[model samples]
Target: MDYQIARHNMVENQVRANKVTDPLVIAAMEEVPRELFLPESKKGVAYVDEDISIGNGRYAIEPMVIARMMQIAEIETTDVALVIGAGFGYSSALLSRVAETVVAIESDATMVEKAEKILQDNNYDNVIVVEGDVVAGYPKQSPYNVIMFDGAVAEVPEAILAQLAEGGRLLAVVREAHKVGVARLYEREHGVIGHRDLFDANVPYLPGFEPVESFVF
Candidate 1:
């Protein structure tokens, strides 16, 4: 299969058609062989418009959604990023192309192993895979200039927000209901984090990042 041509179509059709105009993001998505990150059975649909499940309840978010989120991030060339729920590390791999360094956090051991292997084989030395709690963020590399959550979350945790460097940007899909979610960008200035909705998207929930339910009787 000619993945380069297919990648061009993905960027031009699915991504740009959906309003993702950032050149860096487009280039990264174009360069990365997304099919390499998927299981053999799922590689055929890597660039399709839907999320491809990489197993363990994790899904590689749709290309347009991921591209749009990266566009909204306004990634800086010197920024260091953290990707929560890195999944198959596709997002992290894309991020490594934009950020100076990327620390990808994954809670699933199997997923982490797969992500690490692929990232290494592809020579993504700028990306480091870390196994730990996704909700907590990876503080060892705290105060990151960019932080991105790979899946939908009920709410962005304070712990994660606390890791954002001053003037840093953090993006996530905030799911308000079963089928409703909004992609939001949170930027910290003078130690205060301000947020605004970027777009509407619904992706698989990153386990442990969900909001705690209240009991009312």
Candidate 2:
């Protein structure tokens, strides 16, 4: 496959026309080989504008959703970023360039292994892929400048919010009822005080992020 052409098409058709105009994000997408991150069986479909299934109950977010969330996060060159539900390390690779350091958290052991190999092969030194549950978040690298849920969540748990630094920001596609929208949440000294929905998207559901179930007597 002509990777360059596919990347260009992704920038033009999926990102630009869809309103993700940040130059840094576009450049990152161009730099990272999305196909390399996906499973060998699905490499050809990497940039096809649809979410690809990564093993262990996780799915990579679509190009449009990734681009849009990255653009909305307004990541700075010096910012520290955290990516939850990092399936094949696609989002982690894309974020490495925009943020100073990227901490990618994946729950599935096999997927983490695959992602780690891919990131190392690409020489992305700024990223660290670790296995962990999404609900707990990665506290070892707390106080992230930008926290991104790379998949859709039923609700943002307070545990994750506690990891964000003061004035840090988080972006995620929140699925409320049946509707879904990308939300940008800001953390302040007191707490995660404010957040606003940016746009609607069809993102994959994140495992273990739903509200706790109670016994119905």
lDDT for each residue of candidate 2 in 1-217, tens digit (9 for 90 to 100) = 8988988898899888898889999899878888888778988887898888876667878888888888878899999999988788889999998999999998888888988988998899999998988788899989888999987888888888878887788888887655655555555556645887778776777887653555768
Local distance difference test scores for all models: 0.89, 0.83
lDDT of 2 at 91: 91
For candidate 1, lDDT tens digit of each residue in 72-108?
Answer: 8889989999999988889999999999999999989
| Cα misplacement distance, residue 174 of candidate 1 (Å) | 0.3
Write down the TM-score of every candidate.
Answer: 0.96, 0.92
Where model 1 places Cα greater than 4 Å from the true spot, the runs are 211-216
Point out where model 2 deviates above 4 Å.
181-184, 187-192, 210-217
Winning model by lDDT:
1
